[model samples]
Target: MVNRVPNEWLLYCRAGFEPDLTAEITARAHELDEPGQVVAAESNSGFVRWQSRDSRPANGIHRGLPLMSLVFARQSLVAFEPLSLSRDDRISPVVELIKESGWNFESIWHETPDTNEGKSLSRLAKSLSRPLESALKRGGGLRRKAGGRRLHLFWLAGDAVQIGMSFPGNRSEHPGGVLRLRHPADAPSRSTLKLEEAWHTFVPKEAWESRLHEGMQAVDLGAAPGGWTYQLVRRGMFVYAIDNGPMAPGLMATGQVEHLREDGFVWEPPYRLDWLVCDIVDKPMRVIDMVERWLIKRWCREAIFNLKLPMKKRWEEVQRCLTRLEVTLKAEGIEADIACRHLYHDREEVTVHVRLKGER
Candidate 1:
């Protein structure tokens, strides 16, 4: 048996997650790590915490950090303690296991109505609002020595809340609570931050910005409604939007986008593209083939695409695709960087990014 249990769990969940989905994740986590206590959790933001046990890792982040290396496996890491990735990066099964375990934080071992998973999220949120407000007042993710600072909160839909006080030291506080923010008196506009949560989950602004390739060219397959294209255009990149459906008026008006009424699978770019982005609601293999063809033919320098996931064995499916891509690329004597993550805006699918090894 373990000597001590964790005090809180910080769950990281995808953005815009639903209540039922959150419940399912909690139930699944419970099934995986049984009898252990769940101090707090959220379903939307793609994170969770549970009580520590004898079986849990002693040094939470020491063992839990390696999952960053293998995140493509389509599962999540459970950190028993807080983790800062700037320190360590490794690849080992045991390390991955420990990293996975630590994320399921250990809530306070108290017998209370809030201990129940169903209502614990709201209860925890109410409890921590006081401290969080204090932290915010002082400028979250910041130090007191610095003057007034901006407070940033990354709340998973139903997962754990991460409150960052940005000052010199950039202190971040996770008090195991759900976050509650009051809406403004007036209706927010497009540039306002109000709708940010709906578009992206606890995704760091840097991550989102980095994903954009400005001054780059892209090919959009089935780019109707232009959701993905909107992102690309905002970055100042021209896109070849290929779809039979009508694109959003805003995207079409940009004049940076070109509409082509052609089949995404058979269409060929008039010129080599800098990027290839697709949101085709097609089968996994078919999309995979397009990506493969692009890489093999060297049609594009980099690419970002989506894979609509199946209901069952989702993890295995992602693994298989990754493996196949790796193997194929290797056999072809090609080098590339690949990443797949469940983005804040994605649903039942994952966004994939690929760049040739040598290209910037």
Candidate 2:
């Protein structure tokens, strides 16, 4: 049987974004005083591995790598695997690894890659999840309650699988870091999904009933075709769609949208607002400045915006922008919760989710 000792960290990302993730992980390890290097990561592979050359790195400093601060990776874990498919008892090794973890797993999650080839393993995952659960239960490894740790089975290939574990609140709620959202038929364009994903990522689910309700005030900068505006209107918000181009007629018919035929950069909202969203194709820092003004000047209570990134040194650029955002906010004595992520729908950009820090 072919099996390798598992000693590397596994990170799953969008297929084409492995490099961004690899760069962030390498950078973060160095920053955290963890001396390690990315052992292997190829474009479109959906995963990256960081191998630490020195065991018990950095004199055993208990530092948790800043996984949440990352802009490219989707899901991350420390794992080891690649069990032989030829073994008659392939499931035995997988179960054995889980037992050895010494965790009281509350649930089991089986995930496949994000590529078309990855989808081929879905049926296999479905078939295995229940059996694995049963075995774990029989072995007293599965917890009866729902709040304990969870186990992750990542299927990287037909013959290769990686085993890992994650805490419930600390890790992503979606399996494999992919959020499954249905495209609303009436939405102007797919771009609407980006804002929706941002809300879901940054806002807690239980608070949705109160926070995303009717009569909210919002503005969509560069909202030409009105995808972002469509989301606010759907939630019964009166929106100012700022752009120089025409908007979707369906959105206008709602009578809640004010189509501002002017530049979002120069335009300002007439009154204080509940939300601000920007999707302009401007320089990243410029976009940051635009969003920061809305927050610092108290023009809007919260915002979600995108920063168009450069071709090279993308991770460094992201770090710089985040730092500037934090420093600017601190200098002004503004309390705000800021979160950024490279969403599944984003391309060459990352999305920011910000709200007044007073509210949860």
TM-score of each: 0.58, 0.90
Q: Which pairs clash (backbone N, Cα, C closer than 3 Å) in model 2?
A: 6-80
Stretches of candidate 1 exceeding 4 Å from the true structure? 5-11, 14-214
In the range 10-129, model 2's lDDT, one tens digit per residue, is 778888777788788777777776766787787787888776554332212112654466678787665554444433444667777666645557888888878888889998878777
lDDT of 2: 0.79
- Residue 253 error for model 1, in Å? 2.2
lDDT of 2 at 121: 91
Task: Report the C-alpha displacement of residue 284, candidate 2, in angstroms.
Answer: 1.1
Among these predictions, the greatest TM-score belongs to: 2
Q: For model 1, what is the alpha-carbon lDDT of residue 197? A: 29
Local accuracy of candidate 1 as per-residue lDDT tens digits, 1-360: 212223233334433333323344445445454444445544333344444554453234313322222222222223334322211221122123233333211111111111244344555445544554443333322234335332333332233323222222222222222222333333212211212222232334565555445777888788776766766676688989899988777677878989898999988877788878777888877888889989988899877777887866555566678778888988999998786655434567766767887764
